[model samples]
Target chain A: MTNFVQLILNLLIFPGGLFAVALGLFLMGIDRKIAARLQRRVGPPVYQPFIDLVKLTRKEMVVPGTAHLQAFWLAPLLGFAGMMAAVTLIPIAGVYQGFKYSGDLLVLLYLLALPAIALMIGGSASSSPFGAVGFSREMVMMMSYELPLLVVLVTIALKVGLATGGIATFSLSEIVQFQLENGALLFDYTMLPALLAFLVFIPGNMGVVPFDIPEAETEIVEGPILEYSGTGLALFKLMTSLKMIVVLGLAIALFFPTPLGKNFLVNLLWFFLKCLVLMVIAITIVRTSTGRVRMDQAFKFYLRYPTVLALISLVLTLLQR
Target chain B: MKKLLQKIAKKSPWLYRINAGSCNGCDVELATTACIPRYDVERLGCKYCGSPKHADIVLITGPLTARVKEKVLRLYDEIPDPKVTVAIGVCPISGGVFRDSYAISGPIDNFIPVDVNVPGCPPRPQAIIDGIVEAIKIWETRL
Candidate 1:
């Protein structure tokens, strides 16, 4: 009887890997549709992302005569692997696929860095002037955003530490469990600054609007992926979709309350509802706002504003204790 | 039967704009017309098609300058037919600022029988939206 129960638990966890890919793709589709609707135009169907990937995968690889074909090939694969590793680390629906460590938050952050770094290296190796300029901008963008993001993570962890009697839990699963037991962070007055940090982090993490300087379509011709085509392009696109889902999951885990469900499907539904609301808000702001600041302006804003907010939240976390 | 379905599917007229030589004033208004709490073009079932072949209406802006003329014509020809062309902005309609320049090829209508002409130095978003709506009505009438 115990063996049968263990087998059932294994079945439940294995499907989550596949589910992460599907959920990621779906969130991306909705982001496009919502962004389009916000612009007052009908956007592509949600399935349009899938169609694009399929088409790109079938297309022949184009290698520019002057470009490093090897780096270009490896970049997308590294990006995809990094994101998959992050997803596997996240304990979604209380089911993790194999690797779940107490120090997984550190692993998750480093894994998240891989996609952008891969793009930077790949773009710089392209030997095109446009690619070089784009890679330079991407490097500056990474520097600016990651500082505020790290500060925000520390602030949240600080709050969780206070609530749980100074245990210093960095595991995402523990953080969510804390919220489930003591109500969501949004309900706590001490967490208001952290909430604001979350609001900034959402768009900044996705590299959309006000912060999308790296891929500003008008200024840069599609940015870091400008030289990419065929399967390479498809992998980059897939990483984008997966990245959105991962960020949304983090937001849901951090701020929103997860309701108790009688079954696995019901719990998944509840989790998705919290995630979808967070996603819609992020995408809507991107679509409605049309200000693309210079790289310096973007750098100044994130460092001064969100980074400061995260610091204040950390202080507040202490006082609330 | 698949071909017929594709043809029917093509008629509702999804458009994508490409600015070859025009001032960006037109692109600004075009973006605004499609944003929320405004005209809400999504309700119309028309979309901003990303590629030319997927689009039924190719909205061309700006005068035909020499450097961009080849690229523009190639993009225009790439659109699969049962398609309509709309000359947007006074520049594309009558070569506004660029007329009589050595680089220009004159009004867009000279090369393509424009299904619609939206006239303005750089037309207002509403005017552009209205022109596309009118084009759709004409398409429905033909159907």
Candidate 2:
């Protein structure tokens, strides 16, 4: 009973629900501020997203007459719930130990696809032509990015399993443990390509500039989400921010989760700093520096670059084993 | 609780542009308010959203031409309640150069409740920004 209670607490209070949401919003706010500063302009305050959320809750929700009401109402919750679960699976070194499961990584890989799937469902259910276009484009982007992500995960699983005298371990805690003892994989020459591939994958999965074709504001007017207003739009925004945390957390757990000292508070702060740095590099700078690419070009770019990069690491890890 | 929510919500009024049927001049100035750093509206916690559903401030450009009058009204109706309309340029306010043309049907307030008017042949980005600020004030009361 105590264990069950602890699980619930972990899911709702500490690392998963409220804390993750706050941290995610903070990271997003910082991303916007940095992007604005990069352009030599004063941006909205860091609390802007929080204000937006509050505002959305008070606004009236307008459902399209042609919308599939059930699906449209349910879509945002799917991604939000998935990310909430995904956050608990990621262990922060010396801070919060993640839920221990032998196959959590595999589970996470599936959970990570939920947001994209939700977007596609919502888009198609909206009955808008723009929504249909967004649905197709989102599917292509997901397919292209998933391949490289799969390859990268397999490579990491192999690297850890080989060193620990196992076939493969898809456990995140074990991965973090291995790195803590044997040094982070970030410094491993063979893991470099995989790290690069993951870096490339970040912007794509986050749907920032250069790959935000699905919700291209100028072209499709936010596509699937164009019709969603009030609380629905707020939920979608929260889901994206939560996703930012999940992806960045996963990368930290995978690569450089070396906690600072043994102090709990210090380690937590350290973990946040790492997330901020990663967000700036992988999302902010890249988004600020680039323009949207054509859907075909983005598909081809993901397939060619990150896919090959992750494949190189997979082959190297296999050869080393 | 409602009052506090209204206070917090007032800070994030998203703007949506509706091109009723002008010569694209006001639209160009509207773009500058977002694109040019010198006149950045984001600092006001204003974002230019693509859909009417997400908008809090309706920025109507161009004259209300007979061809697009119906579509414009439909678009305005699509914006959820508690929205303030800001007519940009003389066109939306009085049809400007297109006034009395056989195809023109503006002075937009005839159909939409325009709350603010930024009048210029093509209003300067600063004036448009000022109009947006005025609309946000009206929007706050409604919220």
Candidate 3:
């Protein structure tokens, strides 16, 4: 009973729900501010995303007459719920131990695909031509990125499993525990390719520039989300921010789950700082410096580069064993 | 609580642009206003959104021509309620150089209620920014 209550609290109050949302929005705000500065412009305040969400709630929601109302309404909630669940599964080094399950990493792998699936469902259900186009592009992007991500996860799992005298361990806690006993995989020369592949995966999964083909504003006018307004739009924004936390948090856990000190609050802040640094390196800088790529080009790029990079790590991990 | 939300909401006003078949001059200026660091509208918490549904302020450029009058009106209607419309360039107001042309159908106020007018053949970026500021004020009242 106590465990159930703790799980609920973790999912709703701390580390997963409220805390994750706030941190995600803050990271997004910082990304925008830094991007603007990169372009020599004065950006919106760091709290701009929070204000935008507030404004979205006040506006009227316009549902397209042609849209499939059920799917259109349910898509955002599906993605949001998935992220909420995924966040609880992530261990926060010294602060939180995460959900203790043997195959939590595999569950996370499946959960990570939920938002893209939500996007595809929403786009197709919208009944707009641009939405149709977006749906196809989004599916292709997902397929292209998923292969590399699967390889990367397997590589890490195998590396840890072999080192700890097993075949493969899909438990996130075990991965963190191994790292704590030894050191972070981030410093491991063999894992560098996987790390780099994960970095590339960040922007693609987050749907930023060079990989924002599915929601290309210029060509498709925001595509799948074009028809969403008011509260529906706000939900989508919240989902994206939550996704930021999940992806960044997952990256931190997998590669470098090191805590600063023994204090819980200090470790929590340190984790946030790491997320911020990772966001800037992987998402912000890449987005600011690059332009959008064609959907086919992006598909080809992901397949050729990150897949090969992750595969190299997989091979190296196997060879090391 | 509603009042507090409104006050906070007033800070963000995503802008959407509609072209009513005017010459590309004003469109270029709008682009400059968005792209150039000198007249950064983002500082005002204004984002140039691609979809009308996401817009809080509609920036309509071009003289409404017979070709695009229906399309422009439809686009304007697509924007959710409590939106402020800012007519950019004299073309939207008097149809500018196209006023007497048979192809022109504007003086856009006839079709859509324009809340602010920045009058010029092609208004400078600063004037456009000023017009957007005025639109934001009008938008706040509606919220």
Candidate 4:
């Protein structure tokens, strides 16, 4: 009874549902503001995303006539629910303990792919030609980025596990515990390459400017989401926001789970600060300065650089072990 | 509750453009106002959406030609309810230079309900922006 209630609480209140959504939307607003400023334009207020959400909820939702009704409706919900669950499993050094069990990281690995899968499903089910184009591009992108991501995860697991005298720890909590006991992986010279690889992977996973080919509005007419409007569109927006929190939170947990002090409030603030810095470095500046890469170029770039960087880190870790 | 939602929902008005078959003059002005820093509409919480379904304030450019009238009406129908249409150039409103051409199909307002008209052979950037502001006002009431 207690476990079920706790699980519900974990999914709904503290780290995942409301809190994650709020934080993610806020971050998105900040990103937009910063991007606009960088281009020397006055952007919308930071509460603009919130306003957009309210507007979306109030507007009418239109589904394409020829589309598969069930899949079209359920895709956004699937992504939203998956990200909510994934957030519950990510531990923040002093503030949260995460799901402290073996194979939680592996579970997160699979769960992290759900949004992309949901996008593909939604796009293909919409039955629009643009959606079909988007579906194929998204599938290729998933195949390309998942490699470096897998390598980075395995490299971190081995580096931590070997240092702590084990094979490889798939438990995220244990990885955080190990890092907290020692120093953060951010300061470790050997882990820097892996960190860089993960940083490169961030924009792709988040679907920001340079990596946003699948949903390129100018080219494919918003692609997968072209047919969605109102509440259904709002769900997709909400899903992306939660995804931002999950991805940024995951990066913080994997690379630098260090606490500033014993106070919960101070540490929580510090956690947000780190997330802000990570967002600025990995997402905002990169998105603002770069143009969108062609599908083939992006696929090659991810496969070549990040995958190799992560592989290098893995090889180093294995050699040291 | 409905009133409160409407009040807040007025901020974001996603814009979509349709070329009725005029030349590209008005389209350039629209793009410049939205994309260039000098006349950024994003400050007004306006975005240029790629799809009609995602649009709120529709910007219709060009004069309605005989060939594209059916397509334009179909696209307009796709933009689910409570949408405001802004006829961008003089072409859309009066057919501008192509007033009596066999290819031209009268004025745009003959078919669709135009909420705002920014008139010129191709309206100036300032005029286009003003039309957008008026469209926003009309759009707020609809929301």
Best by DockQ: 3
- lDDT tens digits, residue span B9-40, model 1: 43335566878688877777776653233765
RMSD of each: 6.2, 0.9, 0.9, 1.1
DockQ values per model? 0.12, 0.88, 0.89, 0.82
Candidate 2's TM-score reads 0.99
Per-residue alpha-carbon lDDT of candidate 2 for residues A1-321, written as tens digits (9 for 90 to 100) = 999999999899999999999999988888888988999889899989999999998889998889998998889999889999999998999988897889999999999999999999889988899899999999999999999999999999999999999988899999999999999999999999999999999999999998999999999989888888899988899999999999999999999999999999999999999999999999999999999999999999999999999999999998987
Question: What is candidate 1's lDDT per residue for A26-109, written digit by digit as tens?
Answer: 777777687776665666677656655544543345555688878878888888767765665555554332334577677778
Per-residue lDDT tens digits for candidate 3, residues A2-23, read 9889989999999899999998
* Predicted structure 3: lDDT: 0.91
Docking class of 4: high
- Per-residue lDDT of A96 in model 1: 36
lDDT by residue (A33-112, candidate 4, tens digit) is 98889989998898889999998887788888899999998999998899999999989888989997999999999999
Who is ahead in DockQ, 1 or 3? Answer: 3
Q: Which residue pairs come into collision in candidate 1? A: A38-B36, A39-B34, A39-B35, A40-B34, A40-B35
Residues B31-120, candidate 4, lDDT per residue (tens digit)? 875446887888888888898988899999988999999999999999976699999988988888898999998599899999999998
- Whole-structure CA lDDT of model 4: 0.90
Tell me how far the alpha carbon of residue A294 in candidate 3 is from the true structure, in angstroms, after superposition: 1.1
